[model samples]
Target: ARRRLYPKPFPGIPYNKVSANRIAGDLPELIPVIKATNEYSTSMFAISTQRLRLPLAQDPREIEDILVRRGREFDRAPMSIKTLKNFFPYSFMGKYNTPEVKEQKRIWADAFGADFLRKVAAPSIYNATLDLADGRPFEVVEDLHNATLDAIWVALVGEEAGITRHEIKKFLQSQRDASDGGRRDPGPPPRGYLLRREVDYVSEMIAKNSSSGIPVLAQKLAAYLPRHRQFRRTVDTEIGLVMRKAVDRFQRLELGRLEAGENDTCMMDLVLRRKVLEAKKLGRPLMDPTKDKVLLDDTFLMMFASYPTAQTELRAALKVAFPHPTTPSVDELLGADIPYLDAACEESLRLAGVAKGNLRQTVVDTHIMGHFVPKGAEIFMNYHVDHAPYPVDEEKRSASSQAAGAKLAAREGISRGDVSRDLGSFEPRRWLVKDEKTGQEVFDAYALPQLAFGGGYRGCSGRKLAVMEFRTVVALLVLNLEFLELPEEMKTLKASETIFRLPDMPFASLRAL
Candidate 1:
C-alpha cells in the first residue's frame, strides 16, 4: 500500500523544502499537492518525496485525536540538548516534571485562569494598546510586541521593565543576532548583546554565592572588578539594582493592599501567599527575600517564553488580514465580532507553525496509521500538515453556505461580481452575523479553527492569558491608529523560530494615520 500511493516521488517541487525560508515564502503553493498526497495515503502507507521528510496528516482532527487522546503513549520529541542547553542551562538542574516545577506551574495556571485574565490582565493590555498608538506612525508589529511584552511584564513582575521604543528596536536586533549566527561574528556586539552577557555574568555570580559562603554582593563586585568587565558590570549591577527595587516595591505595595483589605489576586501576590501558607503548614522559617528571587527568575523566564510568540502572531495576522491597509479601524474590527478575530489568530498560528513539530517518543510499540511504530520509536506530529486546508464536513459546508446566502442577500443592490469568492480567506465577516434572508437569520459556521493554543493536557497553560492579550491589543490598535505598510526597505522582515516565534528583522517606517 505504501509503495503504490507514491510510486513516483514528485521531483523538483520547490515547496517541499521545510526550511524556514521555504515554509514562510512558499507554503501556499505546496499545500494542495501535499493535501492530495495525504488523501491518497489515508488507508495506505506512503513515503514523502520532500527533502524535509515531512509526513502528511490527512487532517487536523487526525493529529489532535492521536496527540490529545493517546498522549501518554508519546513524549516530547527529541531536540538538540546542546542547543537547548546554551539557552536554558538550568533545565538540567532538575527533572522535567519535578514536584517543585509542577507546583510552580499550578500556581501560574491558577493565576492566569479565565477570571483573573479578564480582570487584571485585560485592562493592562487595553492600556498598552492606547500607549502604543499615541499619535505616531509606528511599525505595527514592533509597537504591538513591545506593548504585549510590557503588559505581560507588569503582570508577572508587579513592575515595568521600563521598555522604551528604542529599547524594543535594540532588543529585536540582538535577538536576530543571537539566532542568525551573528553572535559568532567578530567585533563588538550591540547593547542587547552586552545585556545578555551581563545576565550570564550575574547568573554565575548567583551560583557562586549559593555554593560558597561568599555574599552575593561581594561575588558580584569581584566578577566586575576587571577593566574589560566595567561595561558588563554596569549592566549587571543596574539589572540587579532594578530587580531589588522591584522586589521592594512589590513588598510595600502588597503589604499596603493587604492592610487596606484588598484581595491578593495578582500572580506575584498569589505566589507570595502560597509560599507563606506552605511555610506555616510545614513549620518552616519565613524567607521572603529568597522566595522573591525565585519568583522573579521564573517570571523572567516565562516572559521570555511568552512575549515573542504573541508578537509574531499579531504581526502575521495583520500582515495577512490587512495586506494593503495601514490598519483596520476599531469600528470595523469590533463590528466583526470575537469569532472573526479568533479565526484570524488561529490562521496566523497555523501558518507561522512555531516549534518545528510536537515531540513524542513512543512508550510502547504502536501501530500508527498502519505503520508499526516500534516501542521507544520517536514520533513527531507535523503541525504544518495538520493545519493545511482541506475539504470540510457536511455540517460545516451547510453553515458556510447559509452564511454566504445571507451575505449576498444583505448586499442585494451590489453586483455579484463585487462579492468575495473565498469566504474562508481572512474574511472577518464570516465570523460576524449572517445576512438576513426575507427577515430570517442565517448563521455562519460554528466549527472553530484549531491552531494557536493546542488542545488537551499539555496544551499551552497560558492560552487564556494569551488570547486576552491578543484581542485587547488588536482591538486597541484598530481603534487608535491606521496600519499603513512600512517602507520597502523596512518591509523585508524575517522570522526567527526559537521555542516560540520572533521577528528576524524590525518592521520599521510604518506611519500612523
Candidate 2:
C-alpha cells in the first residue's frame, strides 16, 4: 500500500485502497482530502503502492516547477499514453518525450500559429456568429461543437477539402456523439453499418474512457473478464477504421493540392511546405513517414480537445456575459480591451477546469519542491486541488451583501439586484479591481490559482487560438441575445456523467435580445 512504501517521512492522504477506489466517483468524499493535503498538509504528497507512486502536486509553484521550470526532466505520463492512444493515434497527447514529439510540437506551433488564426479560424468563427444570430433556438452546446468542427476543417485541410459530403459530416458527428458523456441510441453507427456491433462497443469504450485515465494494467485486467475481451478485440478494429479514414481523407486533400499546384492559406499548406523545406535540408524526397503521422493526428486532436472545451467555456461565459445584451461588432471584439469578459473566461476556466490536471513522468531522480522524486515517478498536477478556492467562512458569507443580502432579499419578496431585473451568473464586481495608477479596471487574476490550460513548453500551443474563439463567439453572442436562468430546479448545467466538469446544459434555452 501507498502508506507502507512512501514511509512516514512524507505525509499524504491515508491510503486505503478501498477508499481510494471509491474516491474515483465520490467527489464530495474526495474534496476534503484534496483540501487537507493542499491547504493543511505539505505542498506535495504521495499515493504509492508497489505498482504506482503518484505525487499529488498542489502548490502552483511546485506545479510550475514540474511543468515549466523543469519540463525537460519530464515526459508525457505513461497513463496518458495508455488511455488516450486509441483516440489520439497520431498526436502528441499520448506521446512520450522524444525527438519526434519535439518536432511535432514545432509543427503544431506553426500550424496553430497566429496566421492560422487570422486566415483560417477567425473568419469561420465570425461567420458562425452571424449564422447563430438568425433568431432560432440554438442549442448553444451542439452549435458550438459544429462551429469548431467547421473551423478545424478549414484550418487543417482547407475549406476546399470538401467536407460538405453528408457521410463525412456523419463521421464528425459520430466522434462528437461518442464523447458527449454517454451512449447513443441503440442503433447503427454513422458509418460501417455491417460492423455496427463493433462500432457501438468502440463508441462505448471511448465515451466511457475519454474523460478518465485507466491504468494499462487495469485495462488489461478488465480484458481477462468476458465482456471486456469482446471490447478489446473489436475496439481496435472499429477505432482503427475511423483512424484510417481520417488519415486517408487528410492524404487525399493534401495530394489534391499537390496535383492542382495551388496552395490555400491553411494549416495543410504550412505543414506541407515545412515538410518540403525539411526534406530539402536533409536532402531527402520527403519527410519521414512518422512526421506525416504527426500532422494527421495533430489536426484531429486539435479539433477534438478544443471544440468541447470551447462550448463548455462558452456556456460558462454565457452564465456571466449574456445578460448585458451588448453586441460588439467583430472589429470591436478584435480591437477593444474587454478585460471583464476576459476575466469571466478566466474565471470559468478556473471554476470548471477542462482537465482535472495533467500528468508528467519524472525522467530522473529529480528534486521537486525540495523532495527527491525517484526516476520514473509519475506526477499528477491536481489542478482542482490547486484551484480549490480557499473557503469563505460562514461568518464572512453572512456578512457580505453579495451572498447574504441576495439570499435574504429573495425570501423577503424583494429583487436581489433591485427591481430593474437582469440575469447574470454572479455579480461581476467580485472579479474586478480598479488600478489606481493606470486608472483602468483589471481582473483580480490571482484571486485563485488558475491552471485551466496546463503549464510549460508542453502546455497547449492552441491556447491563443482557443482564447480567440472563446472571446470572439461569446462576445458576439452577448451582442445578439440575453441569457436567462432556467427554473430553480434546472439552475446549473454542470454534469456528473464524467470527471471533466463539463455541463449538461439542461434547459439552457436562449432568448433573442
Candidate 3:
C-alpha cells in the first residue's frame, strides 16, 4: 500500500527525489510556489508522486514540440479535463480530439471567424465599451467584466444583455437614493449592489469549480452542503434560461417571425441556421439546442469563457496603454492603422499571462526532451519560460532534445531579438519594426515568442475574438480617456488563481478625454 501510495519518478526526467517519499508527494513543495506566484509553472523542476506522475517542461523547444508537433503522442491532460468537465462536460475543454469535438470546434471557428468578428461582433463590442467612458470612479476589473459580458451576450444572444448599462444605472440611482450624489467614491459599490442573475450564476460556477483543489470530488459531494445545493440550483436555472432562449430562437425562425436568409444577428441564430441547413441536406429533422447537449453546452461555454479571458487581458492592456506622452484619437484607433496599439495588446498578453500554462497527457510511450514518458503521464508546459529567467541544466536533458535544440539554434535569421532582452520589462516597441519597403512601422508578432494562446491545431479557439476585443477596448479607452496612475495599494500584481489569473485588486481611475 505504501509503495503504491508513494511512487517513484518515471526514470528519465528530473524531479525532486525528496518528494517521492511523502504521501502528499510534491504538493508540500508546490504550495509555496503557487502562493508566491499564483501560477502552477515554476523555475524549479516539478515533483509529483500523487495520483498522477507529472513532469514539468520548461525548455521552449520541448514545450513547442509537445504542443505543436507531437499531437498523436499527447492529448489534453486528464487533470485538466477532470476539473473542467465537472463544470463544462460538453465543452471542448473537457474532451479529447474526438470527431464530435472537431465538429464543435468547426462551428466555434465559424462563429468567431473573420467575417463574423469584423461584421457582427465588432460593432457590439464597440457599443458596449462606449458605456465605460462615464467619468465616475469604478473598479476596473468589475467594470471590464461587465462590459465584456455585455459584448459577448450581444454576440451570443442577439439582444442587449444590458449588464453593464444596468449596473451603471443601478449605481447612479442608488447614489441618488442615498443622498451621496456629491461624493463620488472610487471603489466598488460602497455598500453592495444586486448582481444580475446570469452574472451570479457564472460567478458562482467559476468560483466554486476553479477554486476547489479537487473539483470533481467536490462536485460529487456537493449535495451534502447548502451552498453547493444552491450552486446546483443556480446551474439548473441557468440551463433552463439557455434552453428557453434556444427554443425561442428556433420557434421564431420556424414561424417566420425572424427574417430568414442566414439570420446573421447572433451566434444562437447562426447555429439555428446551420442546423436547419444540415437538416435539409440530410433530410432529417432540425436538432434542438434544448435537446442537443453539444449545442447547449457550447453556447454556455461561449458565454462562460469569452468575457473572463478578455477581461483579464484588458486589465493588463490598460496598465500598458498610452505610455507615450501623446495618445491617438478615436479615428486613428477605429481605422486600425496603429501598430503601437497592436504591440501594446501583445505585450499585455505576455505580461498578464492569464493562462499560466497548458497541460497534456501522453497518449503512448514517448519521450519529451529525450526523457522517456509513458502513456497517461501528465506533462505541464509553463509559459514562464517565454519571459522569466530560469535555470536550464543541459546535462539533464536527453541527447535527442539537445540535438534538436542545436539545430534550432543554428537556424539563420530565426531569433527572439528584442524579446530576449529586458525579460521582465513591458516594452511594446519590441514587437514593432520598420517595414523596409514601405518605410512604415508595423507590428511584428514573430519577433517575440507567443505562447499566450498556446499553439498547434488545438490552440485557443477564441484567440481572434480575444485580441479583437482587447484592441477595441484598449484603443477606445486610450483615445477617449486618461487612465490615472493607480495608487500603490490598488496596483498589486498579485492575482487569484481562478479559471484565469485574475488580478486581486484591479482598480483604476478614468478621466474622459
State each model's CA lDDT, in order.
Answer: 0.47, 0.53, 0.65
Which consecutive 10 residues in model 3 have the weakest lDDT in total? 189-198
TM-score of each: 0.57, 0.64, 0.81
Candidate 2 positional error at 84, Å: 2.3
1 or 3: which has the higher TM-score? Answer: 3
Model 1 scores a C-alpha lDDT of 0.47
Winner by lDDT: 3
Q: Which ten residues in a row are the worst by lDDT in model 1?
A: 37-46
Cα lDDT of model 3 by residue, 277-386, tens digit: 56665678666555666666676677766756533343344445434545433343445456677888898888787777778888898776556788888877766433
- Candidate 2's clash total is 2
lDDT of each residue in 71-184, candidate 2, tens digit only: 668888887687667545568877887787888888767667776677566766666555555444555555554555555555554542222233334545667788996544
Candidate 1 TM-score, C-alpha based = 0.57
| Residue pairs in candidate 2 whose N, alpha carbon or C atoms collide under 3 angstroms | 2-48, 327-479
Task: Give each prediction's root-mean-square deviation over alpha carbons.
Answer: 13.3, 11.5, 5.7
- What local lDDT does model 3 show for residue 183? 54
Top candidate by TM-score: 3
Q: Candidate 1, 124: how far from true, in Å? A: 2.5
Sorted by TM-score (best first), the order is 3, 2, 1
